[model samples]
Target: MTQDNLWQLDAHDIARQTTSGDLRAQDSVGAAIDRMNAVNPDLNAVVVDLSDEAMARAQALDASRDAGTPCGPLHGVPVTIKINVDQKGQATSNGVVALKELIAPDDAPIVRNLQNAGAVVIGRTNTPEFSFRADTDNPLFGRTHNPWGRHISPGGSSGGAGSAVMAGIGALAHGNDIGGSLRFPAAANGAVTVKPGLGRVPAWNPSQSAERGLLAQSMSVQGLITRSARDLHHAMPTMIAPDPRDPFHVPMPWQGRALDGPIKVAFTKNTFGYDLHPEVEAALDTARDALVDAGYKVEDIEPPNVFDCGRDGYRALMGEVYSLMKTDVDAHGSQAIQDIFAVYFQEFPPFLETDLLQIMAKRSHYARQWSLFLEDYPLILTPFLPRPFFKPDRDTEGGEGVHEVLGCAVYSYAMNFLGLPAASVPSRLAHLPQGIQPINIQVVARRWREDMAVDACIAIEDRVGRMCRPLWEHMASS
Candidate 1:
């Protein structure tokens, strides 16, 4: 293999080579830094470059390796952290300009876990204002462009992470999702990611002044975006390492109990009354075929009421957001974000006060229904979005636009509401009239079965192939 583009290697290969003493930690970090410098000017994916610190850390890791110390699973791997998360001394701005000077005094749990596993933070990626929009742009860091071209929106609020990883700026990009942050970007950028189930991955930001709302705490999750599904498997194990900061975190092992026989998957092309794009339908079929070929017992069935679960769940979340975050957003957010939220309220209509209390109680109802459904099908294959990714600032176009961009994303956020693990992987690359882009399909696993979801992602990936090659080719030609 060519060593000229070491930055393109996945986290698995980087760890294998670095731990085996075949590749120097400094070399990997340097390659990633070089790549970031090359593409980030145009992409703006990495808002805060940490090349100096990353290089120093890489040298120290190399010295430790030379001195015969054992390496961590992610030893020498370069990664990016989302700007919304605390990373000690860096600003957890969450894309709000007014909070730009608010530096974190300590690292978030995900940051500690990544560093403990020897992952070097090359840079911090961008997010939308208050990290709420479906498209990544902020008055603080501007817009993060899709590496594929300007035709696509680099899905937010983890848009920067998705754009950076796929652009080869990092092997893995750390991002958190409340609704569809992780999956949105993965789908937009043609990357792979699994949004960990509630309690599966520890999460806590040391810079926070107060506790998040009950639903916010339950729905949000931290995860990584990568170029391949296998990379998620390699990195997520270390990411789930225990952190005492998050009291609700479940200290469960990454690998769960094996099933007795072929895993059954519930497949559906239901778009919840939205117009399901032909490309998305084809992508779902591709995933079904891939799963079937991989020995999964694929059945054409829909899991519970995803539409009701998604709608009520997001409405409930809007209530929590209105209660807990409305002030910060009103005070610090941009007009663009505020207007988008207006449309969001019109679309989902936040349930307030007592209604919020009742909806929060209803969460268990949705989760329980899905849990029973999973008793027969351990996995569910669905479309991440009813259509391909929308253009930049699409959500700002009012109700119809937000509806097209986010309203149709029932599968993306329903998992967050239910706190179930869902993996997003590209099943087909669509060549549209404007340009070529990848269409991602989602595989949601039973609660705490993130490993199974990732395994399913890998199986589909084995058939459809990784998306990075085509993306890189497009970049080169462009």
Candidate 2:
């Protein structure tokens, strides 16, 4: 293969070569770093890279292979971490300037597992301030632009991970989803991200005590961002290995069997009270046709009020989180942190304590209603956003602009509120340049059916290919 081809190959392909001694781990690691050095400056996807550590690990893995030691599932492959997650000795800035000096003393559970599986950590990607917004940028890390069009957003919290994967810096990236952070970026940037069912991958933070303890119980999970669905299936078992520190984690094996019938697929081009851009709806149509061509039963279906999940519920969940974060920022008393506080409180002034209590009371109602609805349908395909990738610097605006965020995010947040698994896969390109359409599908199986969600994604991949390679590869030489 050509030198350029080395960097663009997927993680599974790279691992297979390393396992068979056709490619040394160091060569793969070196090519990945070279790709990072070439494209990261423009994308700003990775902010805290561990080049030396990566090379050392790559060398060690190659030595072990030479010595006849067994290789791990993802042995010698490269990956990046979302900056919001902890990595020992690396700062979990989450794109906050106030926390730049705060370094983590230990790795988050997901990071530890990825390392244990023999993956090389190339660097850490950017996130919104505390992962609060849906675009990746802050005073600390600046903005992560889309590899397709430098002026467009890759999508947030996991935006950096999405950008890096599209730019060929790594084969896979570790991403967390709460309010569609992982899938939004994946869809916007024309990659793929899986929001595993809650507790599928253990989660914890040694950096600080948990914020709003209920957030620990609901609406968040970690999984992989990749260019292909098969990669997710390959990595799932290693990712969810039981970690005793995370009590919420269930010990489920990665293995799963596909149902023994033509899969009944349900699709919603838009969501409750949300308007999808015309191009996005067209992309869904294209995706539906692909499934029909694959001999599956495809039907247009409207999901019940499940999309209203966490309206009041999120008020209780996120309102409590906002208050806790306010307390921390106020403790620092820094002008920057204070400024963030002002924007937050101004955006959510009516969040009184009594209102929060009422919202919490409604959580079970929404969760139960959503659970009941999913029993009839196995999959719900929808638009990843009301629109495709929007212009960069657009999301930083709050207030009225926040409405735009909500409208675009209709399909994403509800899954978090219900703690169901969802995956975003690239469907086709929109009319705009580098503007690819991503099929935002929620696989709402019973609790612990993350396997079903991922399996559906693999089926989608078999029918329609993943996103086209980002233009950055060609532009990198410029």
Candidate 3:
């Protein structure tokens, strides 16, 4: 591929060619940097550019290749790291001005893993204050616009990762998900990602002075966002590499044992009490049709109670936040974010004291039920959001806005609480009044079977096609 279009290729192809000496690492990284410079001004997706160091690393990689040094699996593939995670010398800013000087002394596990696999870091991406909002904006880095248009938000926490990857800034963008962080962005930007089960990918921030609460430790996960679902298959193995710093990390290989017979998938249109938009229903149908055509035995059946599971889990998480984080948030968070958190507390009232403990214990009960249900059906297909994604700063409109933005996301956070792997993939690209946007559906897999979820995402993608080509054309025309 020519330099102008090199940024369009996925990480797998880039890795294959670079590993075979058919492509130079410098060319790959330079193309990404050039693309970032061209498109990132409007998007604000990348907050910290590391072009100089990236090019230097590329030169060193090329020299090693010339000297016959062994290549890693992701040789020369350009990637972006989320600013909340550590990267040796870069700031783990988490989109807050207070943490802008919090330089990391060492690489976080995911960062070191990507380096070990020969991926080049092109830049660090943006996030909301404290990385808690469902849309990307911060006092430190400003707002990250969706590549599609200003009408829709670039879904947050990992909003930058989604927007950048889909906009062709990098083949892969690193992100983390606590609630619906990864999936939300993937849905908003028409990208693809699988939120790994608990302990699947080792994670820690070297700049942090205190440990996270129990629920935070249990629910949050590290993952990657990419234009094509298969890119996750190529890159996620390295992300799961064991690190001594994370004692709870599961030391497991990427692929799990093949299930016998046709894989069964439990499908549902249950939005609980929320009104399911026609566009969302259409997207779910498309995904279900694609899966059935791909030889999956898709069935109409409800799995576990995701609504209650998600509600209680989030309330319990809020309880922990209330106890441990309110003071810091009140002290350092922007007034906008502070106001959003106030509404958040109103929306999901924190389960206090013994109630928190009880709900935390009940998490295992939900996980067990899901585990048993997964025994019958290896995958569950559901709506990632009950409607199309909302506009930027919708969460700032108070309780009604927060409900619209996050309340309907039962299928998302429930997976995190249950510690089950889930993949988000676009099934439809719709041109709406605001702008053209994608509608994505979630595929929840059995625990530790992130591979299966991504496999289904690949299948759905094979039928519906990826959003990158259309998104690129749209950006060009705009």
Off by over 4 Å in 1: none
As a whole number from 0 to 100, the lDDT of residue 241 in candidate 2 is: 83
lDDT tens digits by residue: candidate 3, 17-65: 9989888999999999999999999999998999999999999999999
Alpha-carbon TM-score of each model against the true structure: 0.99, 0.92, 0.99
Q: Any residue pairs clashing in model 3, and if so which?
A: none
Judged by lDDT, which candidate is best?
3
Q: Give the local distance difference test score of model 3.
A: 0.94
lDDT of 2 by residue, 232-315 (tens): 878878899888878879888876566667777777765556666677777777777776777667778877665555354444
Error of 1 at 286 (Å): 0.7
What is residue 472's positional error in candidate 2, in angstroms?
5.2
User: Which ten residues in a row are the worst by lDDT in model 1?
Assistant: 1-10
Worst 10 residues of 2 by lDDT: 435-444
What is the lDDT for 297 in model 1?
A: 96
Q: RMSD to native for every prediction? A: 0.8, 2.7, 0.7
The Cα RMSD of model 2 versus the native structure comes to 2.7
